[model samples]
Target: MLGPNGAGKSSIYHSIIGLVKPTFGKIIIDGIDVTNIPTHQRCTKFGISWVPQYGGSWSDLTVYDNLVAIAELHIKSKEERLAKVNNLIRKFELQNVVNLKSKFLSGGQVRKLTLAMSMVKNTKILILDEPFAALDPQSVRMIQQIIVSLQMFEKISVSISDHSSRDLLSCVDNAMVLSEGKIVAKGTPPRSDKKY
Candidate 1:
């Protein structure tokens, strides 16, 4: 999704995640109606995972612990939880800060951690709202790389909504422009492909 601020981009994401209730329209995913389903059920039953704009983190928990905690929610075995957590730690390149509390992580690292956290579940569709916001150039590039990796390597469908259309142009295969809560334009996004 490509939209200016207040274009209802975040609202759409929230609605899909069941954070905001829609007045009437049905919410369908993979040809199933999930309209008005609770957020937890939508995530667990529908294979949807979301990362909010500001980065989702349990500030007091260590990087390793954060991954473990989320994994435990879905994976039953102790060994499985540890295995998944460690794998994501490696994949996300957070080995050096594994024991450090998430509150102390840099902005980019926090973003990476949240991405790892989302993968703890068998998520098929990933929703990222305002992913490129409030980051330095290098951090933006780092996040972009991870987003691409998640989509290509993990085979997860990604829906990203951001006001920074230039940054996301190359990242999205299809794009929609929203204005005043309605789609104004949509198609394959124009590629900027600027080297970061």
Candidate 2:
């Protein structure tokens, strides 16, 4: 999704995740209606997860603890939770700061942590809103790589919304443009020589 401010990109994501209900439409996942389902149930039952624009973190908790907490919500066994957390930490290169409070992590680290937390339950559909906002070039590239790997290797379906489409053109298979809460265009992203 590519849109101007207040164009309802975030609203769509919220609605899908059960954070905000739609006034006149249904939300279906895997051909099942889930519009009225609770957020936790949607997550655990449907394998949907979301990462908001501002990274989701328990500021006081250590990176390792944050991952553990998220995993515990859907995973029953302590051994399973630990296994997932450890794998994510290693994949995101977070082991060096695993014991540090999330509040002390750099912007990039927080973003990576949020992504890791969202995957704790083996989410099938991952929604990210403004994932590349407020990050340096290196962080942006790193996150883009991770997103691609998640889809290619983990088989996760990823949906993302952002103001600029530059970073996403190469990663996404389809693009939609929204204006005033309505879709203005939907198709492949413009080629390098063309404008959207």
Candidate 3:
């Protein structure tokens, strides 16, 4: 579902997570219609998670604290929650900055942290907008590797939008292009159209 700026990708994400009600059409996950379900209820049932372009985490909180809170909220067992949060911190290479305030993180770090938080509950479906925005080349490559691993190992369904064709091609098997809030083309996107 990735596209260029102002392509309504965020809008679509919000609608799916129930933050913004759809003006039309149905949102179905796992063969169940959830268009009218409340956001919290949907979180519990469908394991749907979203990381918006401009929102996530408590800025004043340390990276570790923020993830701890998210893990507590989503995971039932105290031990399991702590284990998962620690695993993600290591997986995303956040140990160096785990105690730093989220506001102090570089854009790439924040994006990685946000992605980690979105997977706290092992969500089956994830919608991420601009997941690699403001990342350096190395950070981008690291995130790409994590995403590819998630796809192959977890079989999680992810819809991510990026301006770089390499980002999408590195992780996605399919692409859908949108214009003015409507789908214009649906097919395999190549590595050449990086801006789409």
Candidate 4:
């Protein structure tokens, strides 16, 4: 999804994830009607995971501990939790900063950690809001690469919302433009010479 501020892009994501209910329509996922389902059930049973625009993390906890905490929530076995955390650490290249508190991480590291935490439970649908916000150019490139890799290799359905559409169009197969709580356009990305 791409839209300027106040375009209700985040609301669309919130509605899809069950945080906001639709008054006039049904919310379905994987062929199931999830409109009335509780948020926790929607996440656990429907494999939906969300990463907010500001990023979600236990700021006081170490990077390693943050990953372990999320893994332990859904994974009961101690060995499994350790394995999952370790794998994410490696995949996100957090080995050197594993012991550092999450508050100390750079913008790119924080984004990586948040993404890894969201996928700890093998979520089928991942929603990220304003992922490139507040990121430096280098961090934006790094995060973009990671998102592409996850979509291709992990086969996860990823939905991303950004204020600007240019950077996101190249990576997405489909996109919708929202304005004033309505979808103004829905289609594949336009070529470089065309403007939204």
Candidate 5:
């Protein structure tokens, strides 16, 4: 989703993620009506996961610890948690900062960690809200690359909400432009490859 500030993009995210219940209509996911589902159940049962604006993380915990903590909550097997954590660390390229406190990570690394953290629950759909905000150009580009990869290679469905149409469109295969809580435009990105 591409929308300017206060265009209700985040509000839409909240509704779908169960943070804010919809006043009407069904919030369906994976062919099931999830409007009545709780926030945790939306993720645990429907395979929907999200990273909010500014990214989600435990500031005091190390990068590795953050990944491990999420895995521990969602995965029951001891061996499964270890495997999932290890895969996320390698997938996000956080090997160098594994022991570093999340508060100390660079902007790009923190974004990487948050997205990785969301996947610990076997996320089928990843929703990112304003992921491009408050980052330097380099970090922005890095995140763009990661988003494209997550959809293309990792096979995760992604919906991103950002004011920067150019940046967000570049990372997505399809897009819906929102204005004042309404969808103004919906279509594929100009490029079919969607290579950022």
Candidate 6:
């Protein structure tokens, strides 16, 4: 999703993830209406995962510990969970700082850890809100590449909201522009010079 700030982009994302109840219309995921489902049930029932604009994570925990915690909450079996976490850490190149406290890592490293944590459960839909906010151009490009790689390899449905139309459209297969509380425009095969 490509939208200007305060366009209710995050509101829509919250509604889809079951964080907020929709006033009307239905939220159908994997052919099921989940608008009434609870937040915790949204993940298992709808196979969705959400990472907020801030790149959700535990600031006090080490990178590995944060992943392990989320893994435990959403996955069963210590051995299986550990293996999966380890695989993603290596896949995302997080091994070098996996043991460092999240507060100690650079902005880009923290973003990577947050993304790796989101991938722990193999979700069907991954929603990221304003992922590149405050990121340098180089950092934003790196994150975009990682997201594209994940989608290609895992075949995961991704929804991303960004202030930069160029970044979001370039990375996503589809684009939707929202203004004030509604979708203003939507298209596929994003234009290189597209602007929101």
lDDT of 2 by residue, 10-61 (tens): 9999999899999998999989999989998987797888998885999999
- Kindly list the per-residue Cα lDDT of model 1 for residues 1-196, writing each as its tens digit: 8878788988899889898889978788888888867898888887888999785989999999999888888899998889899998998789999999999999878888887898788878999887777667776777777778777888989999888677887776788899999999888754555332
What tens-digit string does per-residue lDDT give for candidate 4 at 42-134? 888978899987759999999999998888788999998998899888877789999999999987788888988987998788899988777
lDDT of the candidates, in the order given: 0.84, 0.86, 0.82, 0.84, 0.84, 0.81
Question: Measured by TM-score, how close is model 4 to the native structure?
Answer: 0.86
TM-score of each: 0.86, 0.88, 0.90, 0.86, 0.84, 0.85
The C-alpha stretches of model 6 lying farther than 4 A from their native spots are: 74-79, 190-196
lDDT of 5 by residue, 1-196 (tens): 8888899988888999899988887898878898998998777776788888774899999999999888888899999899999997887678999999999998778878887898788667888888777666876777788777778788989888888776787788788888888999999877744657
Residue 6, candidate 4: alpha-carbon lDDT: 91
lDDT of 4: 0.84
Best by lDDT: 2
Off by over 4 Å in 1: 190-196
TM-score, structure 3 vs. true: 0.90
Please identify which of the two predictions, 2 or 6, would achieve the higher TM-score against the true structure: 2
Worst 10 residues of 4 by lDDT: 187-196
Spell out the clash pairs found in candidate 6: none
Tens digits of per-residue lDDT for model 3, 76-111: 998898999999999888999999999999888898
Worst 10 contiguous positions by lDDT, candidate 3: 187-196
